[model samples]
Target: MSFFGELGNPHFRSFEGDIPDNREESIDVEGEGREVVPDATILYTAASFTDRGQVLVEPTGPVLGKAEDAPIDVVGITEGSRVLQINPQETGAEIVVIDIHHTTAQGEEREIAGTASITVGDDGVPTLGSSEPVEQLSTSIAIRGAGAQVAADDHIYLQYSLYEAETGELIDTTWPASPILLDLEGTMEGLQTGIAEAPVGSRLLIQIPAHQAQGTDDLIAIVDILAVHEDEDVDDDMESEPTSTSEPTELSSTEGE
Candidate 1:
């Protein structure tokens, strides 16, 4: 008799339709196959849309949050196409509009308030221009919704963008991709207070002072409230639990190549 044991570990797996991607970066796309994403990311969830001929993968990487492991939802990838970059954010939102724009003189260089002209491109992605720096946190509702209002400690789905306060440079955004989830507690204090009481389906513009933005320069975030729940609904939506039937491709963090 031989003794045998199996170990289960949480990792990323790539699957197309019902078949798994066994070969290294060998996802066939027309004549050229889909290359593997080189970035170190943990696949949060794997959703297959065979009916529409697509495989939706929501992976988590570092970019737009208070910590290293943040929740970011990128759009699904098609069969023939490849996913090069997958960004991660803990909690945020995105939109293009400015209200209550102002600026104050700081020495010689005047800092802009929350005043900036935003433009939405053909892809429905927003682009923001540079403005003066805002030292105080402020929020404005761009689009109001009639749905359920967001409460304290509520789980919310959001699509957001982060930009430099004065430079208006693109930091991170979930536009043209997918929305991420935040438990309301696993985020910054400014974000928590800015999003609280906002109704669902509403877009908001929030300005964060440097003190509240993890001691970094003042930042601006555009948030979209997609859905909100008071319970642990985001866990169910995440689909993070490992399944025995499927084999996932493990991408581990290894030092020195």
Candidate 2:
């Protein structure tokens, strides 16, 4: 007898009931004496499974502190630590956390936090986790001096040494290779000429052209006129001024003769 017939035949001690001819009817038994009852036709659902070893977690977005990730224990996670949940596919991924500190043009300190992911591409090129955006800096260069003076079409020679502003270390032996020259013409020239004629030891601000600087394109130099020498014609003027007379007059003593 077939296994199905033996299961249902009553006279057969092992199979005590009539076998249901329909192939659809079947009994599903769970743990001992417990039967799973279904309302409709039972359909077995199979789940798709994938094998993943261990996943290492890291910071994903912007990072604030220095700590990178949290320590893993069998029980659970530790407090005050960062944990990164990563996929097994990203086994060798690298994580970077950056804290950017910069000084603005207005002399203000700016602190920022950022994070990035690193991976090796198929062509052996290294790529970031995300696109690295370009950053623009609002900055100004400061040129400091006590005083400056200049005249229209007048040539002002700057005699000073260049040094690193921050470290106060001498950068060049003499003044910068190219001295800042100002052409007192139009609006700017008139303004500078007035400043030049003011006095010695004068301080002034001069805007130089882009091409004149040795390495820089645009710059403003604070000029201090340490000394001034005016051109004078002393030789020709000495003979022109009238001289006082102290000669004795000859009296007419012929009258007495």
Candidate 3:
């Protein structure tokens, strides 16, 4: 018997919608017959109402957030129509605005701050710019709220977003999902040292030099220290568990890809 579940996996089924109008025209639109998933949008061209032979755009896809803010101008199409806003009732998450400064692959320096969406400047391969090269691993607590400080061996919950310090590219984030459980003693050396004495509700910006990260490349992380709890008692059969020395491997996020 096969242990893998690929054979048992179900395929997506489809249904056809009744024709809205008897007026027939060739479906010459882009993304014709493509399936749009949840929290997505699409854009297409159709025969113009007045000039039936000429094509015009309905710009925003019928689905929500489906490339609503896509930079079509990158491809030199500037006159395309677009959606002006997304209703929170339809797109569940509250849009957050954060300031981030990055230098692109073309060496262009840019600052994305203020009213633009958090996912606004995701187009380019950007590196987090720094005036001075990082000499050592560093951690700074941005918000210090009233709470108990984390112990070195404590079991706790953490929410974080990891970025590359030099390129400012986002590698991972744990927002919009449940906070991750961590045992400080089993985490990476840099991470364990970084949050050793941090308190709950603390927000930290950490810069880990290349020598202590996942790869030879330097790493930048923004962490929110959440709740902490004690380990529960376990039976002898499970008591000899080996400590995990591996770096964090699972990435979580509530934000759209």
Q: Pick out the ten consecutive residues of candidate 2 with the lowest summed lDDT.
A: 40-49
The C-alpha TM-scores of every prediction are 0.47, 0.20, 0.41
* lDDT per residue as tens, model 3, 1-257: 00111111111122123332223322111211223333223222111111111112211111111223332211211212211111132213111111100011111123332221122134322223332244677776555534568888886666667777666767776443324556777655567778878776566666777666654567776666645543444223212222221235732211222
Instruction: Give the per-residue lDDT of model 2 (tens digit) for 96-153.
Output: 1111110001112222223212233463222223222212111111222223234544
Better of 1 and 3 by lDDT: 1
What ranking emerges by lDDT with the best candidate at the front?
1, 3, 2
The lDDT, on a scale of 0 to 1, for candidate 2 is 0.23
**Cα misplacement distance, residue 106 of candidate 2 (Å):** 28
Q: Which scores higher on lDDT, 1 or 2?
A: 1
Using lDDT, give the best candidate's number. 1
The most accurate candidate by TM-score is 1
Candidate 3 versus the native: TM-score? Answer: 0.41
Candidate 3 regions exceeding 4 Å error are 1-132, 233-247, 250-257
For candidate 1, lDDT tens digit of each residue in 233-253? 222333332211111111011
Q: Least lDDT summed over 10 consecutive residues: which range in candidate 3?
A: 97-106
Question: What stretches of model 1 exceed 4 Å from their correct place?
Answer: 1-114, 230-257
CA-lDDT, candidates in order: 0.42, 0.23, 0.39
For each of the candidates, the C-alpha root-mean-square deviation to the true structure, in angstroms, is: 17.7, 41.2, 19.4
